[model samples]
Target: MPAHFRQERTKIVVTADNEVNIQTLTNWKVSVPFLVMLSDSSNITMPITIEDTLNQCFTQETTEQIIHLSPVCANLLRRVTASDPPFKLISVTPSPVGESGEARCIIQGKGIVSLEAVNQLGEHFLLATTYLSVGEYGIHFSTENLANGVYGIILRAADGREQRSVIVIER
Candidate 1:
C-alpha cells in the first residue's frame, strides 16, 4: 500500500503506480506548481522517504534563485579602517555570467573592510567577512556549481561600513 504525508491543506503521498525504473527513458514529467503548492501547504520540509521505493523523491525545485541588487553607496566611502581611513568598492568586473562560471572584480580605495556576495533579498549568498589589508583589493569568485541567477557583492570595512556590487548569472 502507498502512504501519503499530509498536513493542513498539503498532501504528499507515494503511489505504487509511479514509474519505478527505466533505463531507456531520458526525462520524466512533474508538476512544479502542484509540488510547490503541496509542499508549501504541508509541514514536510525535506529528506522525504518513499517507503518500498528504492529511489527517493529528491527534488531541487525548492532551491532558491536570487537577483542581487547593488547598494546605493557601493562606491561611496562608508567607514574608516583600523588606520582610520575611508573604504569603498572601487570596481568589479565580469558583472554578469552563468552560475557555472567565474566572475572577477577589483575594489580600490583607502582602508580595508569585509566583503561578500548577496542575493536580491539582501541575503548573503557568499560572505567574505575577513578583514582586508589597506589599499586596493581584488576579489575573484568561482560560481561553478551555484544556481543561475543575479547576486550582489557586499563589502564592509573596519569601521562598520558597507558597500555592494551587482552580479548576474544564468544557467
Candidate 2:
C-alpha cells in the first residue's frame, strides 16, 4: 500500500494510489517516513490509512514503490478552487527559475485568488496549483518536474489575504 495525496510536502504522491497484486515474488518494500506518525492513525489530525500498513519492506523480487497514504479525502481536496477569493496577490514570479523553467502569477483584487507553488518556504512544500483561464491576466507554470531549490510562491487570497514569494530554482 503506497498511497499519496499531498497538499503540502515535497515529493509527489499523485494524490493517492494503492495497488497490490502479487501471488509470489521476492523483493518488496515500501516506506513512509518524513514526519510519518501513522500509528494506524485513529486520531485524525492528518491521519491516513488505505489499508493501514504504513511502513514495511523486506524484499526479495517484487518491487513497486511510492507510499505515503492519503486520499480518504485527500486533504479535503487540496484547494486550488473550492472558492476562496478576494484576490489581490498582484504578483509572484521568476526569481531565477530554471529546473524546469516558466513561472508566473498574478491576482487582482476582487475574487478568484488562487495560485500555488511550493518546495519549501515555510514547509508546506506543495508545488503547483492550477486555475486556467488564459488570454490575459497572468498565471503560468511549467517547471518541468521542479527540482532546484527555493520554490515557494503562494497566494490563496480571501479574507486573510495570503501572499508569499521566493522562487530561485536554478538548474
Candidate 3:
C-alpha cells in the first residue's frame, strides 16, 4: 500500500468571499484559508488583508484543505490595501499613438464614477474621458509616442469621488 493510502480528506465550508469555516474532519490538522474582503465594489483591485483560518485541529486532511487556497488572490489584495486609498494598476497595454507603440495605463478603481488618464505635463491623453457606465473603463491615449518616463492616472466622478495612481514605461 502507498504511504498516504490510510489518510482521509477533510471537508470545509466557505463563504462567497472566500471565508472558511471548518466544518468537520477525521483528523485535526489544519491550514489557514486565504481571506478576501471587498473594500470597493466598483473596483475589485484592492484587498483588505492576508490572513489564514485558525488551525484548531492538527490533521493531514485539514492541512491540505487550507493549503488549497490560492496565493495569487492573497498577494494582490495585499498590495492594493498597502496604501491609504486602495486601488491597483491593472496594466499598460499597447495603443495607437501616431503609428507608435504607446502603452495605455489601465487602472482599476473602487466604485468610481469617472476616470481620466493624464501625462506628467497634466494633459489628457485618453478620449471619452468620462466613465459613463459604472464598471471598468478603457482609456486610449492619442498622444505622441510616450517617452521613457512616468504617467499619472486620475479617477474622478461628479459625486466627489477621486483616485490617483502612477504608471511608468521603459519601452
Per-model TM-score, in order, reads 0.36, 0.20, 0.32
The number of the candidate with the highest TM-score is 1
CA error at residue 47 for candidate 1, angstroms: 60
Q: Which digits, one per residue and each the tens of the lDDT, describe model 2 over residues 50-156?
A: 44343332121224344333333222322121122223445555557664333333333334445556676445534545443321255555665656666666656
Model 3 off-target regions past 4 Å? 1-54, 57-59, 62-89, 95-128, 144-149, 157-171
Alpha-carbon local distance difference test for all models:
0.39, 0.41, 0.36
Clashing pairs in 3: 28-57, 28-58, 28-59, 29-57, 29-58, 29-59, 32-53, 42-111, 43-110, 43-111
Against the true structure, candidate 3 reaches a TM-score of: 0.32
- Whichever of 2 and 3 has more TM-score, that candidate is 3
lDDT of 1 by residue, 1-171 (tens): 212222112322232322223123212222321222111111222222233232223322223321111222122222211222234565556556544323233333435445566766766655444445544556555565455566666656544445545556664
The residue ranges of model 2 lying beyond 4 angstroms of the native Cα positions read 3-91, 96-156, 159-162, 167-171
- Model 3, C-alpha of 84: deviation from truth (Å): 23
Which candidate number would show the highest lDDT if scored against the true structure? 2
TM-score of 1: 0.36
